[model samples]
Target: DQQVKQNSPSLSVQEGRISILNCDYTNSMFDYFLWYKKYPAEGPTFLISISSIKDKNEDGRFTVFLNKSAKHLSLHIVPSQPGDSAVYFCAALRGANSKLTFGKGITLSVRP
Candidate 1:
């Protein structure tokens, strides 16, 4: 079974709007959640992260929220910019291991 799921494969938003990317995981062992953003022809780079103990974490225009009970997590980008358009992946790690399990990336398009 797929441990992580991104129900929506893609999301589009106009510039200066809020963009929300969501993910759900079935494994209860996931303790640390991360979000990665990837540009065309580039490797995915870490964007933001939220630990299972915290409900939310914010950095600049990006924020990540985790609802452990629901096995859901979301990334919010405020005033979405065209430059922010990319394939975003939700990842989870258990017990400080180097390996991370990732969900299918969700392509995000920002229209100017």
Candidate 2:
């Protein structure tokens, strides 16, 4: 499953605000680097990570929403805190080899 994640490499946000991140695989030709090679195709070993609708699944202060129709997904951090600063990643499932393609990390910076 190829996805468009539009989050920039760096994000700065004030604490206690909403932080939204997006990524797109269709642009910039970065897709090639994200691919992995695996031998012998097997059935999907595990189901997709669906927790809180693949999820618009939310955990505490973080919420993730996947929009299949728009070919994208977004991660929302509400009331963003300084401790939340970190690099984040996105992944795509390669059904042929039952492998996953992971996008590079996008750094998040929160200001207090």
Candidate 3:
């Protein structure tokens, strides 16, 4: 089973601070990892991703890190703004299906 798990269903952070979200997986074969940001009624947009070959990737205020041995990953957003408040989903892609296996979804509240 390609079950990707997000242990926490929600997180709250203050504006201008760091927000960290975590994800775990049981499948070692999963080589491609992604984090997607979503709003109510809208589709998720790719935020940041790290290939199995790399340990970390970053873009602007967002960063992602992968630990293959632990089968875990995390997303970090620095100076999170109120605009960053949204549901974040951790996803993985492997095998023939480029289709992503997503966590149940977690709502992140950024308080101003």
Candidate 4:
């Protein structure tokens, strides 16, 4: 069974708006959460992450919120832009050197 899931397959947002992506996990042992963005024919690029000890982490326009009790997490992008259009994935890790478990991914489309 898949431990991480992204229920929504896609999302659309206008330029300069906010884009919110969600994810859920079934493993309680996961101690770290990460978000990655990918474009067609390219590898995923790390975006942001949060440790289970913290509730939130932010970088520039990207922010990640984790609700440990609920086994849920979300990524928020403020002032979304056309360049932000890509496949976003949620990933979880148990410890250093451990492989990351990733969600299928959600495609975000930013229209002008």
RMSD of each: 0.8, 9.3, 1.2, 0.9
Worst 10 residues of 4 by lDDT: 93-102
Runs in model 1 lying further than 4 Å from the true structure: none
Best by lDDT: 4
- For 2-103, candidate 3 gives per-residue lDDT tens digits of 489998999999999999999999888777999999999999999998998898999999999999889999999998999999999999988567878998
lDDT of 1 by residue, 1-112 (tens): 7898999999999999999999999998887999999999999999998888999999999999899889999999998999999999999999667679999999999999
Looking at model 1, residue 32 earns an lDDT score of 91
Question: How accurate locally, in lDDT, is each candidate?
Answer: 0.94, 0.55, 0.92, 0.97
The reply for model 4, stretches above 4 Å from the true place, is: none
- Each model's TM-score, in the order given? 0.97, 0.64, 0.95, 0.97
Error of 3 at 102 (Å): 0.8
Please report how far candidate 2 places residue 103 from its true position, in Å.
1.2
Please write out the lDDT profile of model 2 over residues 16-112, one tens digit for every residue.
9998766555533222212111223432222123221243566577666766545566767898988766666655654446555566657678899
Ranking by lDDT: 4, 1, 3, 2
What order do you get sorting by TM-score, best first?
A: 4, 1, 3, 2
User: Over the stretch 1-112, how does candidate 4's per-residue lDDT look in tens digits?
Assistant: 9999999999999999999999999999998999999999999999999999999999999999999999999999999999999999999998967989999999999999
- lDDT (0-100) at residue 1 of candidate 3? 61
